[model samples]
Target: MEARLSKETVLKLSTDHKFGAEGNISTHKVEFIVDSDFGIPGAVTVVNGYDNEFFLESITIEQNFHFACKSWVQPKKLDPEKRIFFFNKAYLPCETPNGVKELRERDLMQLRGDGRGRRVCSDRVYDYDVYNDLGDPIMGDAYARPTLGGQHNPYPTRCRTGRPPSTTDSKTESRPSESELIYVPRDEELEDTKQETIDQGKLMAILRNIMPAIIDKIMGNEEVFDIDHYIKESGQSEFNSQLPLSRILLNLGGAVQEFFKFDPPKTYSRRRSHFLLDDEFGRQVLSAFPLSIESLKVFPPVSKLDPSIYGSVESALKEEHIIGHLEGMSIQQALEENKLFILDYHDVYLPFLERINGLEKRKAYATTTIFFLTKMGTLNPIAIQLALPTGNPNTSSKQVLTPPKDDTSKWLWQLGKAHLLHPHMRYTLKTNAISRQTLINAEGTIETDYTPGRYCMQFTSAAYKDWWRFDMEGIPADLVRRGLAVPDATEPHGIRLLIEDYPFAADGLLIWSSIEKLVRTYVNHYYKNSNAVSSDNELQCWYREFINLGHPDHENATWWPKLANPEDLISMLTTVIWTVSAQHAVLNFGQYPYGGYVPIRPPLIRKLIPKEEDPEYSDFVKDPQRYFLSSLPSLFQATKFMAVINIGSAHSPDEEYIGGRNDVTSWVGEPEIIDAFNQFSMEMKSIEMEIKRRNADPKLRNRCGVDVIPYDLLIPSSGRGATGRGVPNSVTA
Candidate 1:
């Protein structure tokens, strides 16, 4: 049978195509078909089957815009409700000002493997309707649910929340047409759904009064519109009070957009200090799970790396201050034992500190915080160093503060951790920050902005590969590189993390290993062995393009892993899927619950540690608690960050997790491959239960503190909304 099709104007394409544009010729006999205008310079069309029954195998646009050369799709049956999208990248919506510099996919065999599942993921877009009448001001803002972008959500999460029998949790909320493309994709077969753009409207009738507040907060401020070094508060009125626990609900319940009111100095009372400066295990425990566990590294031999931003490594940070906490162990002994860790940000933020601190009320620093892993398997901060730029670039001014000896030092140390953790967010997303959000905006710091055009992909890729090492990204390797683990054949990936009970690495390794095993089985089935892997011209060419085109800067880097064998291929593919799924799940998803309390983990430190000579130092000395409040974000900034994270952290009503079914199993003929995927899914279910058990275990205090919220972020299961939990296959949130 000849493949035939019909078409419409070219909508944008979400190329995270699996079996998508591959043009694979297998046992199937139907010839690939396309529209007459398919190759034209500006083609806008969607392909439908002759009877709207054509399940697309692969798609190609040999001659066209440089942004996307080909489009492939999964062979999902189509009807009136389903259609394959060919949306151009230009028309795609972006939450950040800089449009998608690179569409998720432009090549057939993507840099990230799709053999396991979808390589490209997207978050659904929701229509604006704060009051269902606020209209276009908030139009197209991303919905704050853990949703995916597809025609249908096959495995919509069943929210299993406990209640007093009054709360209503949605079971089958539908997926939306719009999605924010989350990850890059690679090659594989797909039974993809045509992303449909539906014109729909819904509103919370009660939130009518709050619409103005939200619109003003998101759309009104120069702070939201413009970003200097200083982080500004979003607008919050007296009307915008706290919703029981949810900020998203607070605004939706009509408690937002009412007016602008600064969280008064008095409001920043002893309460704010209670979490950071006062609590015993405040900074240490949060780092293990929901926040940046990836940032920790085995304590360095040298305390400082950049002399321009630092004077000497040991001058400020000393051994005695931390040795006391290491259980009578010497500094060298503790480090040798892998018991010492540090979150170092001195090199990343030093340059930005000057600009970030230019504003009078704002204070930022390049910092480092050292930790000692306690016998309890929890990390305890021992020392913190705050460094400020001295304009010389050749010389620096810095101070090292340890766990408090006095009330003054206590507050100072807290400020140091805040200084380090705050900017860590900015730099961690260095790729995103420089490409999509912070620097890519037209008026951003980069004058020769490298985005919004043909070179956008190349520019971002080149810029991306330069900032960090790609080979060291996987969780297992990262752990080893940081000296937190040692090679142990018994362990996953032949490496065992030194911290036996570290929550992030522990939960993630379970998920990571399952993915590796499943992908290894599936890839071996296709490639046969190492010789086949190296001999495949298409695979080798794809490899070159991945290194040279996708990450040009690293093109000559010898450290890059090769797809020369099935094992090599398995390792690489597993990293890709694991990064996008479990890794992204852990790094994200818990932002609001852990950081929502501004006092617990503030993203922006509005004020710097005051010098005794400075006037603010007198005020700080008088009431350090109030001084800390003045130094943090204003009410508006806090709310804005909260709202942003809340939107980001929540799961959509229709999110598909790791084990959730896609159409992968039906087409593959090999029972082994099918069995591999089924086994992977089953193991994922097992992982979900495993994580639940761990969360409930009273012994794992890092996750199950009686007073703490369970660290369920890694549960390969999800339900609707931000439940401080759930891990989908991609970083949709």
Candidate 2:
């Protein structure tokens, strides 16, 4: 058999040979000829490496290659040493998180999140149509999708050649092609695990495992997907009401998925997630949910929602109501004390409401939820105001929904919180996904999601534009931006949070500090001082291109500080590393745990709160439970979305969690740098236990509320499948 090894293979001998000496062992030898063009060895001659009695048969070789683990300085071409390691337990074909053994190829055809999926879109790269978005600031005069010339559109086919393939020749018109039944890529092509096959087999697998169980145990053909369904009997606590949440956190939940990826509620009959969404504890716990509430900030916001127009919801969030929750603290006092924090979605959704509401069975409000930090350090929801842009950007109508004084009001408050989080789930994933190649592999999700038409990109772009705060991808910097913390020069990381019990921030700080220390050590090892940082041409050039070319729009933005000091370099490098590993895990891996349940955390909510004048009002009043279900995605739509998030939440067999795996024995780096990373690994090891302790602590209600489940999203390690924990080192989903 004729066999060939192009490059990237090696078989070494234990005995050492002198520099430039031929490989020799008695009568045996091994020789390799280097490829001149690429400077890589291609031909190897293992000439009788064994005894003369043992004949040399054919020499076989295989090499696994992967894209470099993304640091800010990712290699443009393949670099073997920097390659991310992945496992292909193809033997365990059914071993998928959420039990989705195979994927829905037709449904998820263009939605794959890896190099293989990118290859699928290689031909029908056009999106079946053009989006001449007149308001696109990047293009100045928009005439194309990002795939043509937008963000993360690596191939600018239009720019390279003045025209792209006709928009008419895309999507359905181009005609779909069949895909292989199984994901049978070469041994080297293991990275394409998520979406090589082109059918709904994975979706079918997920539905068969988890989706039907919901109907069988709770809903029982009720035709509704509501948290209330979790409760099996009257007055039963939500804690013991259902087991699927565990099945989701366990069976269906991903054990330790690499890349990508909600809570809370009302009513005893409806089932409550006290740890996730209690009116007082769970709602505030969600402030640190890490999905949509990253927008939470000290209220009255540093800037008003709809600041461009006459945007103010201050009237709706009354001082009396807020002060009632703040004990003796006045609104102004809480603001000064950092006791008041707001997750305001008003400014973001208002501009696009008119267009978004027009989409079929879809409607949303620009919402603002206010939470007051209690004496015990848990956040308590004071007021939630839902607003609608009154057809004018300048004016919006707002109505406040407070903690339930009655039953109608209880579900209303629940509805408000649900809507607050629902709209931003995909956006949060997309924004973070776009933050790093590692944040979320949810690359094509925005386009391929269930949202109607161009509105998906429009909504996502609005979120990105609104959320583009000038902060490093660090929780400390984010907290500072959100006014959740003050910059304290004396604090270890140079910042201290106002709310000490904050789960995501508190747990994240340890991870963040460890990472920063590692970066400082790594950068300081090479550059002795500011002079070195400034003088390094390669470093300076990389930074220049990173800004000028990578984010050209913000190249000259005020936040782009001069890279002249080692400390500055440390900050830059740490941001890159954290964004890829821990930060991305916090954002990505927990999708199925929270979103998998679907009741407490719906991806989208369709109807607005009904009034007497509305026709749906009578129906809502008659059967609020069924009305709410009607507002949610139908069973099929909801289950299909479940499958999407489930797929995003699972890990491939060969997973690389945040700590480099045991197999990664060495890297080409300074001894001190390796030591720093090892230190980081040690610190990361302690994090899971620390988090477990906090969850065990009765004082932290947000984490260990009325349920046995605690916030494990920040847990640094996860097993295979959807385990609701672990931070993958790379974007696996």
Candidate 3:
């Protein structure tokens, strides 16, 4: 066998010899010659060394030679016999890349040799008509049914060059020749043809089987080929109630998927979410529930005891653990009144007051929260009464506006409409304790709901401000004279609770609601103007300006120096909102009686129980007032951490929760979120100090109903009370 090596192969060999073990061990190597054209060794010679011990030298050289051949030995042209044999041998069968063996005849047909190559005999062996007698090539299956295009006809004929083929030409017709014509049909064939008549039923059935597919293809495979056809054919209009809300949502989601891709652009968001604004859906949900008083009647207070409180003051506040016990007898009375007391909002009033003020902003914030929580199924029948100012101040009492007939009706009113108050009224809205208690009673719901039941709400402007104030005639006569029995201060006014005291406070929810509104504002604005916001910087800039961060007229804003970098500020703000919302959730729905019940003992009687003393300490355990007052510092600390979280998750949009998931599936209040909160808390030393110093001031603490002990200690350090293990004691120093 003759074998040829490529230039690379020879070079490789030389490279191996020069660089391998053979090169190292050998001593006969003399010179290396590389071909200038091919870059390979042209010649190599290894001569024996004169003083070699035993090895002989190797010499390799390239040489070329040619000899004249005798005249008679060479042929002038290819011999027929020799050329034929050689051609046959050279054209031997071989496997093609397609794995098919190539035939000699087929291979020969593909080649031409200057019109001098011998024609293979087998090329003409297969005698078939390539053209008709008229010399035009026959095309397709001429034996099948005739077609207008001659390409499909079995027979073919050349057309006259001067003009198109005439219909009058017998050759142009598809009729078969005399020999090919059928004269009579066989009995079986006749019967078969007779039975082949088209059946309407079968044709319709076949069409029904294939029509959908044909329509789908025509419609680009859309699920709904025709909306009217689908609705009418499927009887969808009559089966509306048969579909579950979840199924509807899923269907809506599917429709949304069809239009807007779930895959967000290569931006920060992991997934796109659709948020339905408060509208008919909100109303429908509210309409499904009973009115506040009625709901209270139907869904009675749970018999379960309060959650046991444990952890340090900071941890307790941050963790939202229970602290002290409420006097059972008095609790029963308050429960009868359907009044649930909330201490956090009332005791730590400064932060909220600083963050949110003014009737308009407060109304917007409160309304937004109510609607949001209502959607979350946390609050129930919410009654909001806004008195539209009538031009005539002397309008009859009968003409005065009243609270909505029910929450569903309240839902019918728009936010702007709900903010309008009677000119004579002083407050935004007036809600009774029954509705507030409804919220407290529904704390440990399985659904993870945050909405409270029906509450009386009123929207007013300044007419009755003094009546609702904490000083002078405005103070609730019962609260000042009987509730606390504290002597009226000589001075008229300095600082006081803005509203008359209720049996319970929804301050956490109130503040949380504000945060919730702010969060929604940002998120909604982000989505609404998502197209305009192409980058993180743009989004932050848009939000800052939109929220009116530094504007003097803006009510909802940061009090401290604003972060110069909008991106940082937006991120921190998002984190704050997410963290606060989650924490508020933990406060409201994560446990039963998150802060324990209000004390039943009168203030005078509770004071009688010595501060440092014994068995009676159980009766005098820390109240919500003390718990909230002490937690002010920790609350501020938590706030700072929230800022940290915002900053951390700024660039990564997927890190923060959008409004897609409901309460149960939401990322809020999760352990990871809490961990993030804890991580940032340690960095807020100054904020915590300021909080502590302010809360510790004797005058302020006294005036604000603050306690002497630290917020961490629910029970007196000197004595034991009704203590039960609850939260893991993971308190930060």
Best by lDDT: 2
lDDT of 2 by residue, 192-311 (tens): 233332123364445343644555456543366554332234222223326667654553333222111111212121334342344443443453365354334345443355455646
Tens-digit lDDT string for candidate 3 (1-733) = 1122223211112322432223354533223343454332212212212221112222222322111111111111221111110111111122122211222233334332232322221111111111112211123232211122123222211111111222334343232232341111111011111122212222432433244445545654213221112111122223233689988777666553333211111111111111112232222222111111111211112212112211111111110111112123333343344322221111112112222232221211111111112212222212222121222334311111122344332222322122211010101011111111121111211101111101001111111211222111112222243222233354232122221221111122222233334444444433334333334443455455433422212223243224444333443454444333332222222111111110110000101111235553343243422322221212212222222222211111111122212122122224443343333333233323433454355443211222121221111011111111111111100
Instruction: Tell me the number of clashing residue pairs for each predicted model.
Output: 36, 29, 26
lDDT of 2 at 423: 7
lDDT by residue (1-733, candidate 1, tens digit) is 1223434333332344233233533322223355675333222233442321223333334422222223333223332223233323222122211212222232222233322332223211111100111011122332112121112211111111111111121321222123432222112111222011000101221232143346556664223211111122434333334545576566654433332211221112233334553223433344333223433434443544455444454435666557677788887777667777766666555545665566444566666777777777766777777777676645658777777877776777666666665401111221231223222222222212111111122222323433456677677887777666787998656888766656777787788789888887868667766787787665687677556544443467789887788888887887778777777766667665666556556666666788889988887778776676666655545555555455456665546678775445233335676677788889988988898898788787666764444667788777765566777766454
Worst 10 residues of 1 by lDDT: 193-202
Q: What is the overall TM-score of model 2 with all chains considered together?
A: 0.67
RMSD of each: 16.0, 13.2, 36.5
- C-alpha-based local distance difference test score of model 1: 0.50
lDDT of 2 at 461: 53
TM-score list, all predictions = 0.63, 0.67, 0.17
CA lDDT of each candidate? 0.50, 0.52, 0.23
- Candidate 2, residue 276: the lDDT equals 32
